[model samples]
Target: MCPCGFLLPIHKGETLPSSLTVRRCDLQRFLKVIRGAGLLSRKGIPAWVSLDASSGVLRLRAANTQVEVQLQLEAADSAFEAIVDAEFLKICSGKEASSVTLSLADDEVTASWFDADVPRAARFVLRSSDSVPPAVAAPEILATNEPHLLEALREAQATTDPGASRFALACVQLRSAEGRIAATDSRQLLVQRGYQFPWAGDRLMQITPVFGAQEIDRSQDVQIGEAGNWIAVQAGPWRIAHAVEVEGRFPNVDLVIPSPSSLVSSMSVETGDARFVLERLDKLPCSDTLHEPVTVELNGSVAIRSRQEESAAAVELVLSRTQRNGNECRLQMDRRYLGRALKLGLREVGFTAGGGPCVARDAQRDYVWMGLGQENTISAADVGDRLLSEESVGG
Candidate 1:
C-alpha cells in the first residue's frame, strides 16, 4: 500500500513485470535538462526521447544533431524501455500526482497515478525508432573539481557570434594549457582565467553544451573530456555531449588586448551604479536591439549617456576609484557588449583607456571590444549632468 491509499498491484516482494514507478520530482528533474539542451520544443531540429530501465538503474536520454543530454536515476529491479515524444514527457511530468507508474506497450505508453485517492490514467502514443538514441563514447576523461567551470563557460559563450562566417568564431576556444576559456566575435571578446583542466588538445568546443550545463546542479563536480571531434561533460547524474568544430582554427585573442604599460587612463565604478545607468538608458526610446552606442566619459568621475542623435540624456556618477596618467577620455561602446560583461557578477568594473581595442577588467576576467570611436562632445548646458549621491546606490 502506498501513501496515496492506492496499492500498486504487486505482491509484497514481487515487482511489476512491465511497469516502473517513478517519483514526479525525478521526472521534472530530467525535463529541466531537456529544456536546457534546447530540446523541449517540437519545433525545428526534433529531439529524440528515449527511456530505459534495467539493473536498478533508470536512464532518460534526449538527443539532437547538435547536442545530447542524458539523466540517470535509481529504480527497482525491472526491465523497461520506451521511445516517446518530448511533449509526452512534458505532459506527464506536469501532473500533480506524487508518483506515476509508466507501463510500456507495443505502440503506446500508459501513465497511471493517484490524484487525492482517485486513480487516473493517460495514454500517449509511442514513437517508432529502429534504435535508441546513440551515445557518445569518450575514452578520455579530464575530471576537475574546478568550482567556476560553468560560470566561465556561460561568460565566454555570450561573446560567440552564432552567425559568423568563420565557424571558429561561433564556438568557445578552450585553452587548457593556460587554464582559460575564450570567445570572440571580432567585434567583442571575453576571456576567463583561473581554471585547471587536463585537456591537452586545442580543439574548439561548441557552445551548445553550455545551455545544458546550466541545468546541472552547481554543487556537483563537472567532468570534461574530448573524444576525436566530440566534447562531453558529466555533472552528478546528468551527462552532456556535444560535437566540436573539426577544421576551423580559433584566432589568437591575446593579440587584441592592450598591455598594462600602454593603458593611458583607468577608471573604476561600483557595479550597482553602472547597472543603474545601463538600465536607465535601456528604458529610453531607442532601438530594441543592443546596437545602440553608449558613451563613457572617464575622468575623476564616470558619466554615461545614450548617443541617439535626437535625444539628450545624461547621468554623471561618482567613481569609486580612479588612476590616470593623462587627461580625461571618452569612448563610444555598444550597449549590449557592456551589459554582457556585467552579467559575470563582478563587484567592480575597471575601464582602461588605450589606443587599441577597448578593455574592461574585473578581478577574474578581461573583456575587450573593438570599433570604439570618440563621441560628440556633450556640454553641461545642453543636458545638465544629474550627479547621484554615493549613498543613493547600493552595491
Candidate 2:
C-alpha cells in the first residue's frame, strides 16, 4: 500500500499501477501483457477489477502466496483499482517472451506477436467486423463463480514454473478440430480433446477456464446455443460474461498421459490444506495437471464403483507424494486448458480420470482425455508438427 498521503510520481512512459487507474493505455497494457504467453494465457479472465474512474480511489491487486496487496485507489474526482495478474507483469520484461502487443487506434485493436524465440514479430489484425469484443470492465486473475475452480487450479499447480516444466493435461478447444487452446511453450507441450457440454450446440468446443468451474457451479440458467462463448457468471454484485473458448486446434497431447485405466476410484480434496494448496498452484500452474480430488487408481487395484456430486477439497496440488498409499494418478490434458478450467470454482469437486478428458464424471467410466502428448517438456508448436507427421502417416 502506498503511504497514506504520499505523493508518488507516475513517470510519463511508465503506467500508474494499473489496479488504480482506468487509463485506456494502462488497460490495454494490462491485457497485452497478460495475453503475451502465447498458448498459456488463461482464456476466461475477468474483464476488469472494480473501479470508478470518476472517483479517484486506487485499488491495486497483484497476488503471490495467495495473499495480495490492494492499494485502494482514492481520488475525490475519479478513484479506482486495477486488478492485474502478477504473471502478466513478467511478460513485459522481454526476456522469456512469446507475446503479442495490443495497441488501440481510435477503438481499433491490432495484435503483433512472435510465435517463437527465433522469429520476428508477426501481427494479427482484428477488424471491428472480425472481432466480437464485449465491453471492457475490470480485469482480474480469475473471477466469476470463484472459490472452487480457483481451488482446483491451485490444487493442480500452485506455483507456475517461474522457470519452466513439462506435462500433458486435459483441454477444451472451442474448435479443437480447427486448433484453439494449445500448450505452446517448448518446456510445456499440450495435448487436447474436444468436449461436448450439455449446452453445446453452435457454441464453440472449449477447455473451460479456471473461472469456469464457478460459472457452471452457480449458474441456474444453462442455455446452449443461445449463449456463445460468453458465460455470464453470477456471483459478485455484478454479473460478468467471460470468454471460455479458443479458436484453434488444441494439439493431440495424449501421448504423455498414462494409458487408459480400467481401475477407476473416487478421491476427495484435502481438508485442512485447501488454502495452502490454492496459494501454491496460483504461483505455478506449470506442474502437471493433477488436481487434489482428481480420480485415481492403484496399479492393479480393483475398480471401485462410484460417483460424487459434492466433496469439498482438502488441498489443490498435494502432489503424487501426498497420496495416502503412494497411489496417485497422472492426468493427461492440455495444461493450458486444464489450468483455465479450474480457475473459478467455489469448493473442491469430485473427479475421475479414466483415459481421456471427460470433465471428471465421478469415478466410473472411460471419459475423453482432452489431449495427447507431453506438457511442461514440449511446446504446442512441436506437438503440432508431430501431429502433422501423424496426419501424413494416416493420409
For all predicted structures, in order, the TM-scores are 0.84, 0.26
lDDT of 1 by residue, 50-163 (tens): 888999998888876567778888888988888776665665564453777888766777767655665556666676665444667753767575646776776677778878
CA shift at 367, candidate 2, in angstroms?
A: 7.6
Question: How accurate locally is residue 314 in candidate 1, as Cα lDDT from 0 to 100?
Answer: 49
List, in order, the clash count of every candidate structure: 0, 102
For residues 1-395, what per-residue lDDT tens digits would candidate 2 score against the true structure?
21111122222333222222223334333333223212223355322222234454433232221111122323445433222223333322243323323333333222233324332221222223212223323333322222332233223232222223232223222222422223322223323223222332322222223332322233332212113434332332223233443443334434433342532332333322333333333443222334312222222321111112223212123222112222444333443333333332212222244334323222211122243322222212222111111122221
Those runs of model 1 whose alpha carbons end farther than 4 Å from true positions after fitting are 1-16, 41-45, 95-97, 115-118, 125-133, 209-214, 271-281, 284-290, 307-313, 320-326, 346-356, 389-395
Candidate 2 accuracy as TM-score: 0.26
Residue 125 lDDT in candidate 2? 23
Worst 10 residues of 1 by lDDT: 1-10
